[model samples]
Structure formats: C-alpha cells, structure tokens
Target: MSASLEKGIHALKEQVDSTVAAFFSSCVHCGMCADACLFYTETGEPERMPINKVEPLRRIWKSEYTLLGRIGKLFGLTKKVDDKLLTEWETLVYDSCTLCGRCSMVCPVGNDIALMIRKTREGMAVAGHAPEGLIGATTRAITIGSPMGVKLPALQAQIRHVEESTGKTIPVDVEGAEYMLLLSSMEIMNFPEFIEAVSKIFDRAGVSWTISTEAFEATNSGIQIGVSDLAAELVQRIVDAAEKLKVKTVISPECGHAYMAIRWEGPNLVGKPFSFKVRHILEVLNELREQGKLEISSRETQKLTYHDPCQISRRGGVINEPRSLLDMVADNFVEMPDTGKMNWCCGAGGGVSSNERADEIRLKVFQRKKEQLDAIKPDAIVSACSNCRLNLEDALEEYNMDIPLLSLTEMLADHLAD
Candidate 1:
C-alpha cells in the first residue's frame, strides 16, 4: 500500500477503536434493540442486524484494546489491517447504514449508535470518503450560508415573491421584535408557501415577528455533512442574527432537520445554550390555538395521513403538536401503523436525500413507508420536514403514486381565518 493510504488506514483504525469502544461500553447487548431496527427486519441478514451492525467497529476495538487481540497479532492469528479492509469499512460506514438510531431507544445501556455513526463520519470525512452530494451541499452552505446556495439578495427576492403571492409584507430584521422567524432554504426556494403560511399565522395572531435577510436560512448542511466546525459556524450566524434583532424567541419554519439543528443541537454545536428560546412551527401554532389566536371553523375536507419526520418526531421529541393541529384541520386523519416516535423513516435521514448514489437504496428502504401510505389511500400526506417532504415526493413519483404534499404550516394556514 502507498504511504498515504497506509496512514489513512491507521487513522481510521484509531477512530474506529475509540468510537466502537464508546458504543460497546454503553451497550449490554440485551437484544431489545432488535425490534426497533428496520434493516434487520427487512433483510434478515444477521450482519445487517442492529446489534451485529457494529461488528466491523467492534473487531477494530477488540484488535486494539484486548489482550487476546495482542496475542493474535503477535502470532498472526488475525490479519493485519490493509487497504482493502479500509475500503470495505468505508462502504459499510457510509453507504450501508442510515444512522437512524431506532436501536438506541431499545438499548438498555443507553448506547447512542447514531452518535457513533456521526463520529465515524468524522473519520470518513478526514479520509475524503464522504458522499459527493453531501460534500457539495456543505460546500455551498459554507460559501453562501445555505445548502441551496441562496444568497442574501436572492433570499430577499424570494421573500418579496412570497409577499406578492400572499399579500403580506414580511419585514426583515425589525429591531426589538418579540420574535425572529427563521426559514430553511427549502421553504424559500422550493416551498415558498411554508414561509407565507408562517407570515400569515403571525400576522393573524398579531404577534410581532421579523425575518433576518442576513441570516435568513435555518438549514444547516454542515450538520448533515458531519462537519462539527462548519455546523457550529453556521449556527452562530443564526444566533448572532437573533441577538441583533433582540427577539425574545425565535420560531423555526416547517422543516424537520432545521428544527433539530437549531433547537436540539444548536446549543451544543455553538458551545453554549442560546439565551433565546427556539420553537418549531407546530409548537407555535399550538400556542396560537391555546391562546385563541388561531380559530379553525372548517376541516380540510380531505383524507390525510401524516408521515413523521425522524428529526422532528424522534430527535426533537415533537410528535403530538403536529398531530393536534392536523386533527383540527383534516376531516379525517389516518395514521400509519408505526406513527409518532416509532414511525419508520422516509429513508432520507443522514443527508441521504441528496446522495444520488444512495437514491435507489433510499427508495427501496422507503417502500415500507410507501406501503403504509398506500394502505391509507389518503388525499394528501403531511410532514413537518422539508427533506422528508422532498423524499416522499420523489417516492410518489417513482412508484407512480399520487399524493399531494403539504407542510403542517400549510394546513394550518388553510384553516386560518382570512
């Protein structure tokens, strides 16, 4: 092997050793996590099993830290690490697993496999083994403040377009506002109605809110791409904008990953908890409902089923608020068998939404979710995350299935008193 490749292999081994040790130390391996894994059930491959999924990492850990490993290495009972081995691990770590963390829920020892995957991603990134699509998105976000590469002027133009469509003037960076609304690039570029809905809701509620054209986007492609430094830097932009606006609270638009990045991981990413409170749109709408700021007199008159975005439902622990709002708006609300925290992933987690190479696998994996939606035969499908919405849209197109996609904000906007 070339010296560069050999060095890379050694570094990867160290990373695997530490990450696997952490994961193994946290796990009792009681098999309770088996039921939570979709890959295990779908493929029935023991290697694909959640407990066994970490075997590659475990082998590296044992080889490095155990006495048996030392004896085996001295005697040549175990094969020496090589380039082929590193290549295999690269595929297994990046392409084979989705980092869904359903396993953590059933783990008796509270081992967070999702964190292990993320740490593994750090090693892969250093080795330049990351998925190209995610790397491209991260590059754009670093350069332009959003994955979509929407600049400040383009963002302003989009906001203007939204204003023209909805007849609501979205004031940008108003000083001393009670709230600063943060929008994901998905909303601004692909789903402008989500932004319009948020504006309409705030306007009808008589709540003072402003948008920051400077820090307009809430999408953190850095987090998706597994770069901690870049993720923290992007989050700091949002934090600085919030401080500048002097808002008492910041409201996130209807995007799942955006909500998770800002609300759940923002403080940790930025090294300190934000002084201002952060909330998702559903939470905001629920508050509006409780405060009598929102009134829905008529149902949506459509049969609808809700797809729980993993970030919002599992990571963010927000399952009920969106359902409550949907119940109020939909004439008939049907739920997938595995709903709420237990819901199946749309196969778009961990930046897989943009990975073209993984697109086929993503669709195959999401076939389960598609089956659930087909069973309900709903008029529309509602989700709180942009990635999930986009993935589902693709799935619908791929399978020749037709289901309208609506964000929770859009549904609430439809029911809002005009």
Candidate 2:
C-alpha cells in the first residue's frame, strides 16, 4: 500500500501528458544530455544520463499511450516497470540529478529532460523509492513548518539579534507593508548576518519590508522530494501570511530552490496565481538600484567571481539583476568559466544536501564545479543562494583551497554608502 510497482506505474502513466509524450518522441538519442550532466560528466557513468534517468516513465508512456507501445505491450515485448527497475533508478534520480535544467538547455531536439526528471521523482516518491533524508525533511517541512524544524520562536530570536545589531526594528505582522521577506532555514541558523544585512540595506534604501513569522522558512523540501500536495501546503502558508499582512510584494531570500518554489511553482501547485508579486531578493535590490535608492560607499578591492545558482539564473531568468547589483559595489568582479545561466550546480541542490546517503557521490560530482573554480582562480567567490554558498565552502575546505565565500547581499551591505 505504501510504495509498490503498481502505484509507481500508475503515477508514471498519469504524468505522461502530451508534452512528455512529445519529448520522448522527439528525443533523437543524441546523448548530448550526458555531457551536459555533471554526474555523468564527472563519473563517466552512462546511467547518469538525463534521458536515461526517466527511462521507466518513457517505457510506461510508450506501452500504454503510444500505438507501437500498445502493440509491444500486447506481445509482452515492452519493458516492465518493476521493483528492480525502480530500485536501480532511485540513486540516479534522487542523488545524482539536481534538476538544474542544464540538460534542457543543451538538448539538440529541445527535449526538457530535466522536467521529466522532476516528474519522474513524483513516481519514485510515491513508490517509496525516494531518499530517506528527503523523506525526513519533507516530514519536518509539513509537520513543523520547516525542513530544518525551525520554529517561529527561533526566527524571533534571530530578529531580535538583527534588530539589536542594526538599530533597525525588523517588522513582523505589520499590516500593509510594501514587501514581505522570506528567509531559508539556513539563513536563520547559519547566516543570521543575512537578516542584519537586509535590514541595514532596506533602511538605507527607505524600503518597508517585514519578515513573516507565519512562514519564514522558504526552503520547500516538498518540492525537493517531488511531492505537490506537501509543496502546496507549504506554499499556502506564505500566501495566507502575505494576504493577512496585506503586503504588496513578497521577496524570496537568496536560496535558489526557495525562490523557484514560491516565485515559479507556488501558484501552479496551489492552482492560482499570487495576489502579490514575487521577486528574488536580488531582483528587488536591483530595482532599488535602478531607482537610484541604493548608494554604495566603495567597491570591493579583492578580485572576485560569482557562482550563479542554477535556479535563479538559468531557470528563473534573473541573470542580469545580480551582476548589475555587483557592478555597483564590486570593483574587481570577474566571471567564472561557464558562469551565468550555463553555470555548474553545487551538486547539493534538489534535496541532495538533505540526503546523507548522497554525501560521497555529491562531493565526487562537485568536481564539475571544482573545475569551473580552478579555471577562474578568483580570490573570492560570491553567490546569491545560501545553499550554493554552503556547498562551495564545504568543497573548498575539502580540496584545501584558499577562497572566501561571500553572499551577494552581505557583500553589498558591507559597501553601503556611509
């Protein structure tokens, strides 16, 4: 009843709409996706190919939906979806693939292989083939309102610290603010300086924004675990808060998947568009700069490069906003090789970081990002996503590399006009 081959096949059948069918039909087997994938490229494993990860879904769609597949199924010639097949694909789909969409970009036939992977995860999760770490995180997210189990009181303590540090009172539940800010649990726990930095910058820019005690945790483990029901429940908390507080806009903090969850997938999962506009915090900062509200006192002297979070840049189209903000405060900014929309993933996205079993392979696959960093050899690395920053720091320490990881917002705050 919990996770069976019959349930997985049914989920796969339901997921294979016209679009998935078209992608399966159009895939020319060029194998370009293999090269574009970090796991495949780093390990030289054929099973890690983006197209191959969703083979079960493709085979199910073919046999059940397509004419030739129906004949094959009638003759018992089509590949069957079984426990063994699902067992073999679990690691490839959950641990190796971050759903970064780089393969989608590189597809010669314009196949959205990454989307298929995301869809394939739904079946995997229902089949009880999802990673245990992700399952625990999803449970925490739905039951405790945060994947990390961060409670409102924890955020309250952080707010008090920021308020005392910045001499600016951080607002909470103040009706009719111009913007509502959402922070990832990581920011609350590891990088409280983010809240302090945001408070100072917003004070300087004369912006009115408040943190939501109702839904402060922006990271959606449900999305990472590929469960829409749980994802929608997590998103609705923010919607309820935004509406209750009557905020004009909701600013997604510097978490890649968090931004993607609320800004891109929130409405779709909830079956309606948001009443207030959702902007990545970088986008909001850039808008402030465009309005001539953001003034910088000086520029960074140390040479630096950006590690673009794949969701914010490639998937969300917030490419120029971060660079534009960086230009205002960083004097010696340089591009990492294959930076921007085509940048490499941190290998810990899409709930991989939460999955303890993925630790070894995650670090191994990070060679792709390590190569990108080696090519640039920048003095410092700046990134918008806290998850990417944390992963980069870990990998840097692992390689004994000397580099400082800086948050784009924190860096900007340091150079604020006095």
The residue-by-residue lDDT of candidate 2 on 61-169, one tens digit each, is 8899999989989999999888788889999999989999999999998898989999998888888899999999999999998898889889999999888877889
Candidate 1 structure quality by residue, lDDT tens digits, 331-386 = 88999887888788787777877677777667777777777787788999988888
TM-score of each: 0.88, 0.98
Q: How accurate is candidate 1 locally (lDDT)?
A: 0.76
Misplaced by over 4 Å in model 1 are 1-22, 26-35, 40-48, 51-83, 107-110
- TM-score of candidate 2 on Cα atoms, chains taken together: 0.98
lDDT of 2 at 41: 95
